[model samples]
Target: MLQIDLWKRVLIWALVLCGLALAMPNLFYSRVETHNDAVKAIAASGGVASPDQTAEAAEWPSFLPSGLVNLGLDLRGGAHLLAEVQVSDVYADRMDGLWPEVRDTLRAERATIGTIRRVDSAPDELRVQVGEPAQIAQAVALVRDLARPIVSLTGVGASDIDVSAEGADVVVRLSEAEKQATDTRTMQQSLEIIRRRVDEVGTREPTIQRQGEDRVLIQVPGIGSADELKELIGTTARLTFQPVVGRTTDGSADPGARNLLLPSLDNPGEYYIIEDRTVVSGEELTDAQPAFDQNGRPAVNFRFNPAGARKFGTYTAENIGSPFAIVLDSEVISAPVIQSHIAGGSGIITGNFDVEESTQLAVLLRAGALPAKMTFLEERTIGPELGADSIAAGKIACIVAFSAVLIFMALSYGFFGMVANLALIINVGLIFGLLSLIGATLTLPGIAGIVLTIGMAVDANVLVYERIREELKTSKGPARAIELGYERALSAILDANVTTFIIATILFIMGSGPVRGFAVTLALGILTSVFTSIYLTRLFIVMWFERRRPKTIEV
Candidate 1:
């Protein structure tokens, strides 16, 4: 009556062994983590590992599972920042770029519109005043023709730009559909750039996610402070090459409508008036690195893509003796005269830069520019000492709960209680094993979930033991009593755990951060508890029954 099939027996033992094996790595977490990092470094470096790294990797066997549960920001201490992207900034930039196009289109219809002049308006609005009011309709129609349909699922057939006329002035702005599309793309690009910048520092698992339409939440574990992280991502890094018109000491110089007056990076009070039209943009850069100039000064070397190279080469060849300004975020970094017809798409940017500035500049150039400026709304730093205290407290709570549950089970049903205790222990191991295998982050709340699980795990064993006691009073054989006990308890165990598991699943799907962590451990605990109680405990009981051959015994 208490017999288990060979396949079932083997399966039970296999699962137990695998769980133990997986959980073993957590006991040697530091060693395993070091091994894992070394392996990753070596792989990233194309198998060229340092002697120390090779030694560290060799300390842990290659055959063993090296996965470890990642510690959360709360437990590892990190920087947290919530930034809001200024999506409207991109709108202004887009409008500024459209000026050249709008001017060209209106000039083609110069006979109708008369004189067309750009007027100052809101940052998001593009206003153009025409001398001839009668031709306003023609001007609006021409501007509207430039509008392309928004390329998005929700905004299909909607125009990218909206053109309207108020008397002789034509007003243009990005349509609502285009704004939505631009916001989505901007947020996605911001997230990617932020991730790349953070990853470049080699910080472990960082949580960089979009909070809402314009906000991004960044949490980097093991980071010193929020300021450090902000410094890394806050730079706009907008690099442009413009034809320089003249240099002046006047900060308030009006450099005409088509020119921009930008301050020099090295020289205070010096400004350079440069043409607004860009010869080359940083977006066309394929690679950038920190290197030394011909004079051995720290500088940033850059290589342009083919299209950028062609444009830059042609511009340089045409304006051989004229100075071109290298502008970074509206600051004139340099205005070097074209010495000769420079070709091949390669150039060096030399400023009054030290080694550190050059390196940071290089990193920013390589990561690409943010689509929009970000204003940090919230910033926080978690200290490692606090995390240590939390971990210590969590460990104490777990040990206390575990000891209490084990003692209660032992006192209630004697030998059967001991069997339940063994299963409970294995269940805990299985929970850790599964967590490690899946690389789930464990938080303080997750520790609480495991503690709660320890108390709940004994419920199945109690049900079986009580049922067995009742069957024994009815004069059923010990083996037969035990068999019926498990059979009767199966439905109750499944129903109760399934309902709880469903709740845990819902929590996991809907919840974020710590709540998800709790749900993970809770769900895993439920599964492991069921397996150990039904199969593992029964196996032990069956083995005992066969060995003793007792006619009557206590559960």
Candidate 2:
């Protein structure tokens, strides 16, 4: 009948084979497997993202019989979580967190402050004390709020603002109700501080929200691999650099308070106290990375922006030979005394940290920063037994669906039915081979997509065969009939697949998650079926015709 040249036959067969190879992974491979727990633990323990991704295969063999489609999260009984960021408290806490330094540092300069202390402080004020009766007038004049109503006004025109001295037997007490109110306000500030810290660690699609005044609920799915989530949500401690107080202009220590030396963690090192204040903070970090020093000891290298770098250099310069604390969330991770002024925008954080924590820190730093902290509300791991059940159910569905298609094709078109069966067989083979070659995850809906492909692919052969019968019945010669059959059937064949293709395109564009998997399989099936049915099957027919010459055509 239709004469397919040897090259056309070979080329068509090659394409069919290629498609099979690409689909192999979908048909045979297990989609759901195992997650790395070691990395997850690290993540929880203040580790970072970018864990070493070397995962070992589970010893338990796959329960999935070969050649099945896999379902996605919905049918697979996986957990999902929703969370939101806490912003209100985060901003308020950040401002207040910076307020203390703003207050006392100005006082050491003898700048007059008012409303500086809280009434047992419901909200701590940077109030100014009336200086030794005489300097008070001059101090108030220079530091006066230029705008009216900015500083609280009392005593007609504030001839003098009054306050008890910081160190005298002076005492200001709050009533029971006032203390409760102050504590509530501070808790609000603390809650906001928590949020800013969480936002610093950019866990993917993480949801952080204020549950009560002080707590935030966080949900991170697909992020439960290691303690990374734990670490990410909790590292909200802030870092600050303050000038040393009670130090003389010549750098000699004053009598007390400012020169206090605190012991370093697990070391003989000590850090000299600066003014009991913090000026610059670690809120503007841009990037960080893990590297090794000359001795090959693991370390974390960091860089800050122009603003951060300039401030950092200034802090280090002033604190040379003095220890500065690297505080995480609240606990000090490292408090190394500064050896020298660290300028030029970058520096290293070093300690007894192993390679893992150092790298995790770098990754956390590079994920920019989290805006707020979170508390893990819930977590669960899918059992391998459940994965096995899914695999088994998926197989049964595929087998039942597949056999039904096979039986229908055989009965519907008789001799041509057999040819359709051959094409169908090749179609599925190509699907598996192609999936394996490409290594696409085979979800369960993806299986349904493959099964649906059967109806579409089988329909194409039916169209061609039915058209061939029409042409043969028209009394044309066998060669002309066969050629015209393929030619005339091409328009209808293409039209049917083109319509299905449009549907597949819509599915691909609109679907999310597993629905997308369906669309992908459907789209791929449409293309493969068109090529194999029209091209490969025709080639087979051509080769058969060449070998089996007959005198007359059978009606």
Candidate lDDT (C-alpha), each: 0.90, 0.57
As a TM-score, model 2 comes out at 0.61
Tens digits of per-residue lDDT, candidate 2, 137-224, equal 4443443322122122222233211223343111222323333443454445444443443444433223344455444454332343
Estimate the TM-score of every prediction.
Answer: 0.83, 0.61
List the candidate 2 regions with Cα displacement exceeding 4 Å: 4-14, 21-79, 90-286, 292-297, 305-307, 375-379, 429-441, 550-555
User: Once superposed on the true structure, which residue ranges of model 1 sit more than 4 Å away at CA?
Assistant: 51-59, 152-157, 239-367
lDDT by residue (10-101, candidate 1, tens digit) is 99999999998999898898899889989987785568899999999987899998888777788878899999999999999999999989
The residue pairs that clash in candidate 1, if any, are: none
Q: By how many angstroms RMSD does model 1 differ from the true structure?
A: 4.3
Root-mean-square deviation of every model: 4.3, 11.5
Displacement of residue 436 (Cα, Å) in model 2 is 6.2
